[model samples]
Target: MIPVADAFRSGGAQPGQDALALTGFAAEGARAVFTVAGAEEGASGLTVHYRTQGEETATVTLLANGTEVERLALPGTAGAWDTLETGVPLRAGLNTVTLRTASGDNGAFELSGITVADAAPAPTRGAALPYTAYEAEAGTTDGTVIGPDRTYLTVPSEASGRQAVVLEETGSHVEFELTEPANALTLRHSIPDSADGTGIDATLSLYVNGEHHRDLELTSRHAWVYGEYPYTNNPAEGSPHRFFDESRVLLDEELPAGTVLRLQKDAEDTADSYTVDLLEAETAPGPGTMPDGFVDATERGVTPDDGSDDTAALNEALAQTSSEGLGLWLPPGDYHISDHVNLTGATLRGAGEWHTVLRGSDGLGGFFGRGGTSVVQDLTLDGGATVRDDAGDHAAFEGDFGSGSTLQNIWIEHSKVGLWIQSPTDGLLATGLRIRDTYADGVNLHRGTANTEVTHSSIRNTGDDGLAMWSESEAVSDSAFRFNTVQVPLLANAVGIYGGHANGVEDNVLADTVTSSAGIAISTRFSPVPFSGTTSVRRNTLLRTGGYEPNWDSAFGALWIYADTSDITAPVVVNDLEIVDSTYSGILVSWQRTVTELSVSDVEITGTGRFGIEINAAGSGTFSGVRVSGAAEGGLDLTGGFTVERGEGNSGW
Candidate 1:
């Protein structure tokens, strides 16, 4: 056996030893050296209650044969030996389990009890995994799409079948809850523990209702950690809950209180012993307003019936409120306004994250060029369900106030159009907006706007493009579109991330698209051109293209763009950019007209069809770094497409 005590006493623990003692092993003046061992077994597992005497910081190790198997960190104390269960396989006959005071503080060590047995079989995996989905906080609930592990919930149904996902968190603790608690829910997060001073033996528990279901043992030495607890069952039965009640217990402690859940530790020294950190929960649809802190509007006498002549009272209150002002809550009932509901300086908040909804009725239609400079979150807006189908794409909320308006975590659906922003006062700062599930393009930039950004929001089940806009000076980056549904006639392009100018499309992925609509469709307008611009498309992934299903048409491009006028159809004028690893085609250059200059590189096409890289350079452009292999009938093809300069950098076509 490789005794820890012997190694330390032999001076092998250090490179040099004192003049009066042996070299290496010993620390000039360390107290004592001792050895502890237990029987060994093959396969299964072993449990041993190793006895330790006195108080001294020492190192203990479980050894198999003469080789080290498990390194253990032990505390120095004057108490009875504790039972330690080790799960590891050993050589068939007589494995040597060793323990030694790798340090000099020294104490006695002995095996109180040792037991070896065969290992149990692994648990079998379930036949099918649960599906999950998420709803857009910025638009209306058109259709709900469920994903694997039920991690994603599309449209939380008022009836059944689908559930809502929520993400909740504190500095060191996080909790994920769903709208329909009955559906299967998951709680996954990272916990960064920075405390090491005190001894800590933490037990992680998973509770169903008030009963304990699973328990995990966590050691303090493992400060940086990641853990996931999944609760699966039909929501119709009951939802999973992350229990953090002080009255909860996992393993029973033989104490007076009987079943107690607490941190137990045995420590020797207490120097700079401190640990303070947060457990962040990142499950979908948690219990909190959008973007963390948001106040309710109606609760502050700012509702539609707030005793003002029109929406003027609410509008006036906005200009005098803070950038982080209260939300413009509409409650769950109907609200009517004679004039436009302008919001500026304040916030248009909602009640209970996704519970409270604001519905417009009568002559009010829904909303107008309102909420100039406000932060909107966690509110559902069902504007004028009474309005006719074709209402000139009116909006539930419009960003006419330029710079100070920020919209995040809002669900606006069942409207002619979610938002029709005409550009507000501030050019670059006129963002922090999110347009989710609207009746039409969630938020149509509609010609006159610049400097807008959309991130981490869902735009699905829209009547038209999930989002589409155009402005010679506009750009869009870091946006996404996945499963937006359509019922009757069609739901068009799930996402139209296009504009006449430099529309920077990057880091976006779309899957299971069913329509002829482009996940991202953009086109150049020539009628009224701007001073300078070229569309820069890069870093996008498209999965399951083609709307052949009940959703959209199959001719969909995860990312697609074209020129408005036929005269400028070819792929020419596009400039310095990179399109890589897209769904069907890493970078699909779809242009009807000709261009001045274009370059395509490092593009990976995923799917089954034509060339990985297709240059529709009816105009004139460059194509390079094109990768195509997974699908594509041919590899590289050129119809109206071409390249004055083209070839491979990362092309695997």
Candidate 2:
């Protein structure tokens, strides 16, 4: 290991010295060169300790005998030094290394030192690794790096508890030094804002050991920077929360030790930026087990198939749990609940999904209700009683919570509504569920829900939307639907956000939605609150949508955004809303004179029964980086009043 003490010693160092000394701060076009002697050369790596003084990016080109090897994008470190490494081909005798600013800007940096070493061995991965958020605050939760115990280099002052890194321009990169080689990196990031008021649309290219590996285009629907936008009514109540687009970039090649992960923008002209909050490196598979600390429902006389009401016994068991953290386990039983079972501040688990079934009766239309800091997992909720013809509504599970409620690994079938949730609720996580054949919506989060997630689940044969987030009276902000499979919703959308702030639906597959409405729908006509938060729809595939409508002129788009004929005084401003990387069959954007600011990018329309994107919004929106083919009607059906920044690849409609 090269000591920090030895790196500061500069000037006229011997070629065979263990560490190479070089100056970092220099004017544009001025080259700072250093020499290193290789002991034996097949393939060697170079470790660099350098940093920048200001916000500008610094790029250094390395040369071996006047031949360029690679260009390394060095991240700006405000004022403190950071470390990075690169793979370089070396001759057996001597090699030359050069550094220069990437652009003609007034960029300056501090080169602490460089060292040549042998390439690292292959990685041996074991368990999935968790990386804690490294807050940019100095003395807060910013101590350890993710995999190995390493301190964070000095970060930009713009970073805070929410965003760990804030990127500005194209080709600007943020470098991370891995303590151990990581096979894959999973991180959550979001765009703060765009220059033209559209949402984020850019490709992020990854560099490993100063060599280009791969790139993935990212789009964001919300701002991670606090105070960047007027989110709430009181501007002082800026969103402290972060809505990260959870992205996993694969490293098909092994990342050796001394790896430098450089994330740089690939575009050249656009002035958009993004922020990262949390990052995790997967060394192995993720953990799957029930969380500890819970009382057994069987111990409290909640037996299986006894023809007796066990809801009271299960509730009593949850009441008897420790006050610090409430929990109860229903182990492999069909427990009947003839009355409404209400729960709060508790956790209910089971042996498995089908093993433990909670059967509901006609007197108890709503099965299990929950609120506040609760979890329901690994069980089936069977609404054995059919809905009465005169009844208003009923659900298998319903929650009206404040925060931190999760429903996981559960099955609910043959219900009027599988799960109906109204909010005061925030931070709800619903994953690993199988919900099918619902008379109404499979799951609905309406009115004041915030920061909720529904991921990795399957919902099919729903009468209404498979999943919907609506802001009837309050802002439903910062919620997400990811990696979900929705099939055959009979009446309404497969997935929809009626009106919300900074919500996202990504990486989901929707098929056989026999509705005239969009398979994926977004609208603001029904919102009681003023709508303008960023809503992102990306990386989703819709198969065979928008063939039927309940009424004429109803079923329109595969991915639809509407404002309708609402006379709401406040403009329905969807600032930085984006739909990208989606494959659709119906009309793409069904704009009905309502959307204020929007962007559509990287959209591939394979088949559209109507138009590709029909825009009639009152204000200007952009359609860039889109490709349209196999559409029956035109690519874009503009009904006037919208300005589109038509980019590239839009043809053959």
Candidate 3:
């Protein structure tokens, strides 16, 4: 991927660090050229990230090596950055790719970046190949349509298409026709909770065509929360909210396109009501296999699927693998562990998340990585803990990895936390992680974690922040979170940066923050170290974020900048943000002491409950290319000592 600012341009294209703003299109021969170094290139896929507004679509001509390749129509995004992918021919070494206006109508747009790869990027482990999402409201339903609303905290507001179907009566159902062949399906739904607030188990029946296919077990145990920050499952403390959970299942046979899939609340179903949000269908890949030269854990007396304790055997296998300098492999079965397994300079592999299962009960313990390179992948960690245990060291995985270490394709559920990495670790890449139902933060880089990255992961139903970098003892710098989807965090922000430097949150989608904070937050609340370097928040989409803060008796913004504990004195850049259906303000800048040098550019705010941009800090900033619509309390409500040098193309104030 190459940023547009790094490319060579002509004909009045304004180049900036965040994007290339194309203007003066009436000029002759206006174009931008990119030099791409390809490795053995033949046929490659090209993806361009760009943003534009207005009703008219833009047209760009693509030329490779000075030859006309294709004319691409760039659709207007209503001011949000979107991607377009196409096939491009390339030579082995250096290739010059150029984009020029193909039509007389300029229809301005900003180019963010472009990526050229050998093919379309491969899907992460357990992700649906050729995935297609169908919204419940768009399907044929005999149920009640609940909302396009976001004000009610107890109802889920971050649903796709901003509305959902509620099946309140028995036999009420929603049906959708498959557009492609699929063998696996994932349903996002919410059901009424039990009166006592411990959650309830229910069932929903699936029908293929007119025949009964299967029954799905749905539970509210992983959803719903109440009370203050770092919330609780008990209802008496506060109003209940965060009302959604997901369930996935693989079919016995692949269904053909045009097959009618139906979800019905039949008489046998246990729930009083079922709220259907969305369904995703995909053709899933086959299970994984153990690689050669790896030591199988069964050889060390570890018996799987026997419902017996395998903790001792797994620990012995770990020690042997560490001593022999070999990787440990667990085959396709369930292994029960009652205590934590220590991993030192070890690699543990499993036969895919759908096959290998590590289950534990109340005394459930996690895997701890220490010393040299520790790699864990392709397994499910099921901490069968029913409730939050604040004092328990029950994270599914804890401690930091050595340089060049990774945790990949791992599924963690019902744990105190997931993948809590400690300080001083660098170059730890965590990708393809599915962490849900965690009592606390899903992934937390705690202090001094530098040059690490978390990408292509999914996290939901976390008690605290879904993904966070807390610079408590040492500044967590030079880390990044990109291309991840975080949804329905029951408390706090979806992504939180507490006093980090040179850290970036980019190309991520965050939605449905329940209470106490924003969707993406940059704050000085916990870190003791002074802020330094530039903090970047770019190209992120926030949906239905912001909720009431009980302690402050107020609400937050969808994207918040707050200096609570210390003055934020570093340059912060927020660019290419799209905030939709914000429950409160779209963007909030507040400080207790002082803040300086904030730059916000190329943002779109739609359907905000309060002001689009609310500033209450003692700071100066530059704002540009910001557009807001459907804000109830107007836009740009500036107060306090905050001053702005307003840049070009700002409206809706």
- The TM-scores of all predictions, comma-separated, are 0.48, 0.53, 0.79
Q: How do the residues 142-172 of candidate 1 rate in per-residue lDDT, one tens digit apiece?
A: 2222221211122221101122222221111
Q: What would the per-residue lDDT of candidate 2 be over residues 193-284, giving only the tens digit for each residue?
A: 34332346556676777888887556543222233221211224443222234344545655665676666655752436555544545332
Ranking by TM-score: 3, 2, 1
Worst 10 residues of 1 by lDDT: 122-131
Better of 1 and 2 by TM-score: 2
Report RMSD (Å) for each prediction in the order shown: 24.4, 24.1, 12.2
Question: On lDDT, who's better, 2 or 3?
Answer: 3
For residue 220, give model 3's deviation from the true position in Å.
Answer: 3.4
In model 2, state the lDDT of residue 173.
61
User: Which parts of model 2 are misplaced by more than 4 Å?
Assistant: 1-292, 322-326, 362-370, 385-393, 525-528, 565-585, 588-592
lDDT of each: 0.38, 0.56, 0.78
